[model samples]
Target chain A: MIRVVLLGAGNVAQHLYTALCNQTSVEVIQCYNRKGSKLHPDQKKELVTNTLTELVDADIYILAISDDAIEEVSSNLPFTNRLVVHTSGSVPMDTIHSSNRKGVFYPLQTFSKDKTVDFSTIPFCLEAENEKDYNLLKELGVTLSQKLYKISSQQRNALHVSAVFVNNFTNHLFSIGNDICSDNDIPFEILHPLIRETADKIATMNPDNAQTGPAIRNDHKTINRHIKFLSDTTQKELYQTLTKAIQSKYGKKL
Target chain B: MIRVVLLGAGNVAQHLYTALCNQTSVEVIQCYNRKGSKLHPDQKKELVTNTLTELVDADIYILAISDDAIEEVSSNLPFTNRLVVHTSGSVPMDTIHSSNRKGVFYPLQTFSKDKTVDFSTIPFCLEAENEKDYNLLKELGVTLSQKLYKISSQQRNALHVSAVFVNNFTNHLFSIGNDICSDNDIPFEILHPLIRETADKIATMNPDNAQTGPAIRNDHKTINRHIKFLSDTTQKELYQTLTKAIQSKYGKKL
Candidate 1:
């Protein structure tokens, strides 16, 4: 059996905790948080603790914590030569204390406490200082997701930045769309199918080939009308900038 | 049976043709195109013609053509006083000739000829000058989609602009993510699940509440790192612009 101890108590930590508990071959020896109330719980009192020094013996120490706290927390762990990993995409793996074997078990997904994610399809990006630790990380990741890869800290940093562009920035654009709909007394539900299909199209084709709309076509009349329709100066500037970006990418002179 | 004539042979025209042909109560009497090579065939050769003058008598004429071609095609129709409608989101209703009743039958979905759309869930926005014409447009729209709304020209323009942001801009963001992944030697599929979930989250919650990531949290370090990582000047500018936009929207003084 793989004895595991999960550190931190936020979204990623809680999710990893639940996933680990579900597997018969793994045991979460304990979970620690800086504050007693912050630790995620499902009445699993035997496996919860608040003090950092109270962490018990385990084969793996998974630090699914914030970016800022990773270095400090890993240094404070009162153990040596154990497999210590963090679930961060951008942070380098060497940030873990030199006394322990440093590794990363980054799940390439966004986690929310209330929303249950199906780990089977998520890609687990793993990294380690040595072969044995890498294999161990891979073994645990294989149980959680079917897809696994050995990503370097540099590659993972690129992935994280790309994620911000797709996930975070895309959500912002959607909010802008929602604002336009609500301001015009139109129901936002009307756009759901379109949005879902837009995401699905890329699964089958390259996003460049899947792209459609006025900007790509460079229909100046429609483009100008849309820009004039938007009342907010920021939105107007964004519309102009993104339109120019798309037009340039697609080789449209406009 | 509602006898209808369709004009144009592009993506929207082909989809509408296939949809109308499936209904038991609707008969697409004829479809017109300027070029004979563009027609999609199913042995219904007699109903399609390339000539503008060789049109048949029908209860309604549906001009499912480009926005620029709508006014010209609707004006050249041989029949007079028939209910004529153009399937355009941005085009005004009066673009139709004065000899016929004017209306709009806009299906608010991005259509691809290869992708079969589920018409029942697609939103059809209808508009007309009077009660009788509006009912005629609604009757046809109900046959195509369960979700139907009576939208004016002004409102339709707003919805069109909003669609640009959600569909076009969102797709562009996905492409950028794919580029980053391929550049880093990581498979682009890693970000698919995250993309799907972000879109799904907005279905249940407001996009404002659904927003996450460094910009929303005002984490300047990560944001700065991401901007510096992007080598292209245009993409870097976009990252800064969008990040500032998100920060300002969430009331963070960036």
Candidate 2:
């Protein structure tokens, strides 16, 4: 069985620990953090530690820390020439100390520590310096997730920014929707079904095929009315800007 | 049984017709349009007509036409003092000619002509000048959907604008995400699970509570990197604008 020392006790680390525990073919040697209290309560007490020197020997060390902490954390690891990977989408694998075999095991989905993720549906973006390291990561990935992408560091960076658009910006729009509803004394629950369907439509069709709105239609009358209807200055500007951007995209096509 | 004479053969009109067909308590006496060719093929030919003059008697008439055409079509209904409603969120109920009773039977969800909607989940924003007409529309809504809101013309207008933010603007952000993925040679499908989960999260939590990203966290380092990483000028502008908007929202709170 392959053994792993999971570093950090954040969202990615905790989620990976949960999924890894389900794989009979793999074992978690230990979970390391600056403090043991950060580790989930369900984590085996013996397998959780705050001291970096206390890390057990393992086939691989996965650093699931924040981007800024990655280089220093990898440099602090006492082991060398063993497989070491960080679960970051934007950071280069070379950030790990060159003394160790470097790889990336970025999960291409947003994680909230409180929310349970179905690993089978998430795409694991993997990169490694050697064939053996790649295979090891691939083996682990296959056990945890159905989708595996052999992405370069450059590709992973691009995917990260794209994710910000779909997840981050989309959530902001939903927030603005909530703001608008609450401003007018309407409950936010009324918008839930539409939001769910919007995401579902993109599954069966590309977003380009699925796009529809006054902006795309160049329906100036409706567009102006909406702009006037928006009371918040930021929301108004946002409405105008996105509407123009959408118009430009489809206007070129039409 | 209460009868609805559905006006127009557009996406909303056709979907409502299909839904109304399933309700044993409601009947669609006729579907009025300038051209019957747009009518769904499964609709009985007897129930479809191209002439406005050939309209049949019904308890209510729903003008499921375009926003620009709502006023004109409602004015030319060829009948007087009958309950006439237009299925538009943005249009005011007063747009209907004064000769007939006016009401709004708007289903607050995006409908594509080809894709079917689960009527039971869609919110029917019902509005009328009087309680008698409101109850009649409410009776129709009760037969079709579980979500029925007694919204005023003013509240309905506010809901329409809110729907634009949640559905129209949210979809555009998704399209931008797809564009970013395509530009960087990443398949848009990689982001689907994240997109689905983002929407799913808000069903149980408020959007503000669910929001997470660089701008919300004020991570200017990552934000600048993403803006520089984006090559398209328009996409870059959108990124900066939305990032600033998100920052302003949380920056105030922070």
User: Can you list each candidate's DockQ?
Assistant: 0.84, 0.83
The clash numbers for all candidates, in the given order, read: 0, 0
Q: Can you tell me the DockQ of model 1?
A: 0.84
Error at B117, model 1, angstroms: 2.1
Give the winner by lDDT. Answer: 2
lDDT of 1 by residue, A21-52 (tens): 78888888788887754344464676678878
Question: What i-RMS does each candidate reach, in Å?
Answer: 0.8, 0.9
> What TM-score does prediction 2 earn?
0.97
Worst 10 residues of 1 chain B by lDDT: B36-45
Local error of candidate 1 at residue A63 (angstroms): 0.4
- State the lDDT of candidate 1 residue by residue for B1-254, as single tens digits: 88998988888888998898888889888888887433555737776789988988887888989888888887887878989999998898988889899989889888887888789989898899899989877888888888999899988888899889999999998988898899999898888888988888888989998889999998989998998899977788788889988988887433
RMSD of 1: 1.8
- Docking category of candidate 2: high
